[model samples]
Target chain A: MSSELLFAVVGALIFTLGVAGTVLVANLLRRILAFNLMGSGAFLVLVGLAQRGGESDPVPHAMVLTGIVVAVAATALALALLRKQHEMKDSEEELTEIDDG
Target chain B: MSATLAFDLLLSTALVWSAWRTITANRLDQAVVMFIVFGLLMTLAWCRLRAPDIALAEAAIGAGLTGALLLDALGALRKGKTARRRQ
Candidate 1:
């Protein structure tokens, strides 16, 4: 098989794995990781499919570049939200403990 | 198989393996590390696919910056969620 086909198949497998992990995993952090994995898989499929016609397409390559930047930004946003949620939970617990006392 | 095809197959396997490990790792830290490995393998795959521009971007952004963000997030989340998990 050609490298394009090979990588594209691999990309599909990774995307499926990420979907399962995202849906089934309980940990918030794991969910984020799975989401990132899913993004990478999709990007791979994009590039692989574009090049499968035997040309190194620049359009998909540019798209993947922008996608990577957006993915990183989204990841940062999610993590910040997670940290804020964690802090809120902590304060909530402290309040409950004080009320009980 | 030709040498190039053989190399492609190897890199493909490495990509899937690292991604799977990243999902299944018991520790968040281990998962992040595996994810970084997966990113690096992907950069190599981009180069093989003749997208050198993407290869460079994947190395710097996908592998480098994403890995750093993940590690930092893992560290911050470790204290609270980790405390709960250890129980």
Candidate 2:
């Protein structure tokens, strides 16, 4: 089999695994990590597809590259939101606990 | 087998494993480290895919920047004791 085909197979498997991980993991951080994994796996498949298309198709490669950077930025932003949510939940719990006491 | 194909197989295997572990690691620290390695491996994969520009962007933006951001977030999670989760 060709390298491109190998990559497509592996990439699809990895992408499925990543999606499962994201769904199974309760922690927000782990979810973010899984999302990145899913993004990378998709990118890999896209690159492989581009390779199979031959040397002239730079479009897919360029798009995938853009996607990689965008994914990281989105991850960063989501992490910040998760942090905020954690802080807010903690404060509310503490307030309730103190009131009960 | 051609050398490039062999190398791609090795890289894809390593990357898939590392990324899988990054999500499942018991320790958050270890998970973050594995994720960083996974990112670097992805950069290598981009290069092998005949996209040098993507390789550079992945190395600098995806791996380096993302790792730093993750480490910072990890520290925040550790240092903030005021809002510990009940679970």
For each candidate, give the TM-score of chain B.
0.87, 0.88
**Model 1 over residues B1-87: C-alpha lDDT tens digits?**
599999999899999999899899998788889989999999999999898998898899999998888888777776776665553
Among these predictions, the greatest DockQ belongs to 1
Worst ten in a row by lDDT for model 1 chain A: A89-98
Q: Stretches of candidate 2 above 4 Å error? A: A53-56, B82-87
- Please give the CA lDDT of all the candidate structures: 0.89, 0.83
Identify the candidate with maximal lDDT.
1
Clashes by residue pair, model 1: none
Q: Which pairs in model 2 have colliding backbones?
A: none
Interface RMSD (Å) of model 1? 1.5
TM-score of chain A of 1: 0.97
What is the Å distance of residue B54 in model 2 from its true position? 0.7
TM-score of each predicted structure versus truth: 0.93, 0.91
